[model samples]
Target: MLDLPPDLPRLRTLRTWHEQCLREIDRAIAAAEEQARAEQQAQERRAAATPPPWMVGLQDITGTPEELHQGGCTMWAHRRRKTVTRDQARELLAAGIRACEFCKPDAELGFL
Candidate 1:
């Protein structure tokens, strides 16, 4: 409970005080929204700068590694995929996993 000023003895003065409080609350809300927007932009920038280099597409039924793709490839249709390192992607390709025809991760990794 905030202590009101003892001098707000008139209705007009009380209404003015209420309006001032509301304006202060509005300012606080605006500041919070601005901060949230700035934080979200920073997070988006970070995500864009450090994307995974490779990914392994997985089989829907067995969850086994099915295809290799560059991290930015979108041609993979499987919902199950795993982020992998460049070396891991090469190893998986060498171990008989198929490379995505569209993305051609094997060629990208110099495997072909």
Candidate 2:
């Protein structure tokens, strides 16, 4: 610990000034962080609005080139998705859709 001189008023004034300076520094740091966050959010929003080229069907889901084949029942090959689940596959097969042999919709074949 540091000891202050016997001047009580001067010591109090110094402490007050030190506290005020600390508050100002904190506020400046907070403002900078907020601006950075806002810019990052704006970039994200722009990216979401534009979307990628692969995404042609769903919101962000892309279709595979082999979707033209796989003649089965439900027409699963026609609809492309970002993530294909086991249940979705079954549903498509049950509906008369078939999986693409060349593209292999299950694996990473036609996925752009």
**Please, what is the TM-score per model?**
0.60, 0.44
Clash count, one per candidate: 0, 7
Quote the RMSD, in angstroms, for model 1. 6.3
Query: How big is the positional error of residue 58 in model 1, measured in Å on the Cα after superposition?
Result: 0.9
Highest-scoring model, TM-score: 1
Return the number of clashes found in candidate 2: 7
Give residue 104's lDDT in candidate 1 (0 to 100). 89
For every candidate in turn, the CA RMSD to the true structure comes to 6.3, 9.4
Model 1 Cα lDDT, one tens digit per residue, 1-112: 9666666466678888889999999999999999999999999999887747898989989999989989888876446899999889889988999998998888889988
Candidate 2 residue lDDT tens string, 12-105: 9989999999999999999999999999999999877652222112222444323322223233434653333445544444454544545454
The 10 consecutive residues of candidate 1 with the worst lDDT sum are 2-11
User: Model 1: runs farther than 4 Å from truth?
Assistant: 1-42, 45-51
* True-structure Cα RMSD, model 2: 9.4
